[model samples]
Target: MALMTTRPWKHPKTGIYYLRRAVPADLLARVGKREEKISLGTKDPVRAKGLHASALLELEQRWANLRCGAASLSEREAHELAAPLSAWWFDQHRDEPSQQTFWRTDLGDGLWPRRPPGWSLRPAVGAALIEEAADSSVHARCAMEDWCSEQADALLKRRGLVVDETDRRKLARAVAAVMQRASLALHAAMRGEAVDVGQTLVVRPAMPTSAMATPPAEMAQNSLLPISLTALVEAWWREAERTGKAASTHEAYAHAFRLLVAFLGHDNAHRVTKHDIVRFKDHRLASRKRNGDLVSATTVKNSDLAALKAVFGWALDNGRIIENPALGVTVAKAAKVKLREREFTAEEARTLLRAASDLTPGRELPQTYAAKHWIPWVLAFTGARVGEIAQLRRQDLRRETVAGYPEGVWVLRITPEAGTVKTKQAREVPLHPQLVELGFPAFVEGGRGERLFIVPDVKGQIAGPLQGVKNRLSEFARHHVIDPGVSPNHSWRHRFRTVATEAGVSGNVIDALCGWSAKSVGERYGSVSLKARTDAIMRLPRIEV
Candidate 1:
């Protein structure tokens, strides 16, 4: 039998080519055009099958290439291509494969392919493409956001809503929101109309130009005007101090100035009239210090009136004012009274001494009392001022024997370096026995570098001199409800003088021991020997607790 050879043939109905071998009538009928010749370049079935497979592979590769080309056209590029191509004039210069391709069509000679007329992008389409590009890239997005923020700030400035940089930021955010909504609407409109998708909406920014821009101008030139009564007084005070006025005189001037400042505010200085000064004097007479009893009208007229006169005089000299307000002011004259010195009674002195000895530390009591409870007793015994006690040093203690009596006494030597004395004269006071027993040596020895009294350990470490001792004693008096007027620290001095006099010690000897000037015919009578002074102080009756 003869072998049948197969050949490749194209099917007319399906428009596909296939290998034909062992040809069946029904299959041949399916591909209608029967007279069509099959060509595989051979009459062999095996060779025709290999050729058909190679053709299929080539078709697959062509399909893949078309798909890749379509994918490479980005959303931006596609929008550009679909719109009128003239809008892409800017994009044609951009460094992109799509841009390059478009550029070649526009700029290249016949060497490069020319884009067909219908293929170019329109202006709206190009704008849409740019907007799309802005959204896709970080740099473009930032630029767009910045533009929106700046536009919002300008609007706020124009509307006078920009109070500060903070307000500007808030306005920018608000503008951004508005711009975003407008952009979305524009985008939607363009999409519906099949116009450019990349086009972004941009609104013009407003600028501000008004008087509010430079800040409100001064309503009046009153800022430079002098308004201070205090300033006027201070000007006078400076001149007085410059001329070396006495401190007491200057202090009186200050007190008057304070009263004037209180009556008339600092701003009303130039406007004050003579009537105002008179009214202030009247007010002072009606005022009282601690009690309901008013200040004497005579005192107000005399002392306070004199102080006000000085202030007005200074003000007149310095050109602060044209006239002295206190010039014609009259004060009531005070009657002078003669009074005799009264010493503490024996019973009162004994009660005070007993009170001093019985003193004990309590809660809320001063640290001075807590640390040195015997200080008040020592003061009662010695009649020493707080300053004298604080200024005592270890070397100032002198031990001696007089008439078979041994004595341990600390002498208070007041030099100008030690500070101002009450009488401004140097004198020595004897230390009492109670002071020695209360560890006076520890304080004197430890504080040899400075004053004797160590600052009590208090909150805030407000360490200082004899001021602390005085303050603590005042607190003690108040806590114990002791009549402050009768039993003050100075009262202790009076008690000492009275007790020594009562003990039959001579006034001259007592004066020497207590640092008092003797009231006698001559200065020679006041001067007692150191031995006699010590003897007199020792002979004073010691009341044991």
Candidate 2:
């Protein structure tokens, strides 16, 4: 899959967001343009993001409609399309008793309040008469009908549905009926009778499938039938969750599946075949990144193929399918080349640490300040993954007395309890003596939140706020490091090993402290005690800024 540059573009002059997309080659002729652009009308990034998503959804739906052309609409399809109209009407009028007359008399043919003829001669009465005339039942109904028609037209355009005049009239009639139903419900509310006015009317325009609501086993029995992609992914996710698959991983895989479905132009998972997978692979490989570089083979294999294979395998095991469409698909391996050492050099490490230490307060969030300042130092000493250090909590940092030091050592606990751990196992690394001298303990004690680096509200969302911090940190590091060959945050792990070895720390003890997997069965038999780990950590020298 290609990287998407679908985020809202901000204008340089006005600071307002805009939607910018190039029209597909085939679509250009039909759309009559090379590209489509729309102002999002908001300077606020959050609002712009929401508006952009909605606008993008409608654009995709419109393009899809153009591709398929107009189709015959069944009565059921018309009714389904019009269902939200009723809920919308009910919500708008549920609390207004004055609006009852419009619903009670077919928009007030006999119920309109009349303006006295002689009273119109007086100026005050003339203004009053005009106001009454404007508020009459006939005008109210006309406005209501026009609004409904406009909504129905927009809905049809958004869904890319085209209908003949007769079918369009049929839809208009369906809208009227639904609106009447809403009116009746409103009347019930007025009469102090029970009504379901709180009905949520989210409009989802997905491919219709009978197998969507069926159990996986039942779906397998009718394997030839179409099953919706949404249903398949939901079921897959439920099982995946049970097995302790990371939610962020699921989010990425599910997004990949959606992209596949979009490329396929349908959501039928059952209809997908090996040929489709191969064609998708070819298409993905031919696709390019935003910078015009060809999408990496590694990305296609790891993200797209990996997701498809896992989901399809789950489907097969659950009896939803007899075969996995993604089976045997693989990307050819490229030779691993060592351009330079993956570890940071002494100068590069010092450069990053110095910049971090210089970051002052009040520029960003408290957690961000902590991340920018101490996270580098923590990673440098502990040799932990950047994410592990970024997600550390106040409770995870504790003082414990171990051998060789009755004064106690400050241990940073790397555990899944805080967030995700690659090994699914927890371990503790004693803080380096250099960190203690740098007032790392005072910094940890200063924080008042649950997390030492990440904010509490965003801690639950693995892919949202935490990912934002990671991206920002990467950007911040790259600005100083200026090395495209090495990863900004991850190079610390490599450098730590090098430094530890030079300091004469044992390999197994280094692995344990760094949370690496045991090399052999014997190595796994005995645990690395805090005392031994403390001794090892004490041996390693710290980076001097």
lDDT of 2 by residue, 275-348 (tens): 89988999999999553659889999999999999888666544354346788788898986778999989999
What is the RMSD of candidate 1? 42.1
Count of steric clashes across candidates, in order: 16, 0
lDDT of 1 by residue, 289-308 (tens): 54255877776776777777
TM-score of 2: 0.57
Candidate 1's C-alpha runs over 4 A off are: 1-260, 267-343, 350-355, 358-375, 378-408, 446-472, 478-487, 508-521, 524-526
lDDT of 1 at 171: 46
